[model samples]
Target: MIRTLDGKEEGFPSPLIQIRRQQSHLENWLENHKFPRIPCQSFVVISSPSTIIKAPKSLKSQILHSANIPYKLGVLEKKFKEQLLTKPTLKKLSKTLMEKHTEEDVDLFAKYNISKNDILTGVQCPGCGQFPAKRTQGFWRCSFCKHKAKDAHLRTLEEYKYLFGNKISNQQLRSFLHISSRTSATKFFSTLNYVHEGRTKDRVYFIP
Candidate 1:
């Protein structure tokens, strides 16, 4: 589950539903693989510090345990200890899994048919997770939450590297970051330890 800093769930699959789905998937995978039908437990842990999930009583009772942040961490530790495998068993399982494991590269963006044009572009507010924070006097200020962050553009650039690719041009950065000033975009690029190819207008920056 993903939430904004303001504590709102951004996407689908509520905690209870997600946990049920996980349980179902686990059972299916084990059966398909011809593995022993070992007992399994599923948990929906909301790690966002600001987010407090208030599930229905009926749903809560059905779930194994739904905890938040640090509390969830403790539960995880306890669960792991309870299901702890011996060193020999661990080694055997690892060896068995490794023999059947095969690495596959997946392009999720393409597979999901997500368009670059549909993606929101701007400096996002770190405090409230709002976008299009105005660049003001060496700091990015959010009009919504009144949060100001210095070097906020750095986070936006890092996101760009993930959503797009490692290589980006000055114009592309400006468009994606909603930056109008070429000098400002260049200044932002200079702070990063990146490699560049081509000269002047044709130059492209690569995150090394």
Candidate 2:
């Protein structure tokens, strides 16, 4: 006899034990009813809906019926034969399916207004100022007028700011500009004729 938490004698066979036994029996029945064979990689052509399949000689009608795979051996063979006959049609169908899938992908991208360039580059060159300088065989040219400067200028200015703490000396400016000679550097500096509120050596040039 089993006793419940409420202090009552349940029965010789408790409700919990009976339920477990029933569950086990049901599981065994289901396992026995399941099909023994796995499905093959064969695909049926949709062109002929009345096609059939033929099972192997080893699998009898009684066994097939027990497995619940509803098909006679003759019907299975007929279906396979029909599939072979419709090979050309299947190829055309496959090609059309691929084309339709590709078209759908393209349409989805277009709907989102996403650009290929955006995918490649994090930011698109806005073509602002002289950015994305026109490319020549050996150098990049300005997209604007014929105003051309050596590629070195862009890098030099940045270096000048770093070296001189932004209060660039005349000599330092020349070095930044990459002038070949000190004389040429001085000449360029004189052209600016910048005058600051200090002595000559301490004077800073300001762009006019």
Candidate 3:
């Protein structure tokens, strides 16, 4: 399912050619894997119910709103129930697909013309929803709420790694996590068993 913020619609998501090309790519991949060819269906959902969607009749995808999903899903269940793969084959296929999968790195900050340095440091305090909570000695304390946490830095690191990059430097972690003291930052680094490479400032840490 797909949705657009503006109640605007083009022929097949973007243009006429891309849908067929993408479907062909999927079919080729399935053929290479010796799997059954599946039908490609498309759906575009829009928030504004008042706005009409002028979809092309040639396309296989449907354009609908959230209100129509339940009925559409009911109809789709029949197709899903028609095919049944053996338990072992299904498990093996799923495992193999997972093992061979590659992740695409996306840099949202750069795409949106935002600077990483401008981002607020430290974990957002859950109690007060305030940013860059002070990294006091042995605690992450929110100045406004007077709330303190020990493991708040962990959540901040997870966001940093997700939105920025999979790997982080000691300096990056310290700056982003709002740790002023190098000794404390090093101490925090010691707590994690992340895989490391390079020497001194050249070093990077990533989940093994």
Judged by TM-score, which candidate is best?
3
lDDT tens digits by residue: candidate 3, 79-106: 6776656778778778878987898777
What is candidate 1's CA lDDT for residue 203? Answer: 95
**Candidate 2: tens digits of C-alpha lDDT, residues 1-208:** 3335577656454333455576666555434644222223222222333323343554333222222334544566665563332567556645754664542123433667865344321111223334334324323355554444435243434434433334656666654443445566556567556443446666566433
lDDT of model 3, residue 175: 79
TM-score of each: 0.52, 0.22, 0.67
| Runs of candidate 1 exceeding 4 Å displacement | 1-105
lDDT of 1 at 126: 93
Write down the lDDT that model 3 would get: 0.74
Higher-lDDT candidate of 2 and 3: 3
- TM-score order, best first, reads 3, 1, 2
Q: Which of candidates 2 and 3 is the stronger one according to TM-score?
A: 3
lDDT of 1 by residue, 164-187 (tens): 877999999889878778998898
Give me the displacement of residue 23 in model 3, in angstroms. Answer: 3.8
Clashing pairs in 2: 52-75, 52-76, 53-75, 53-76, 53-77, 54-73, 54-76, 54-77
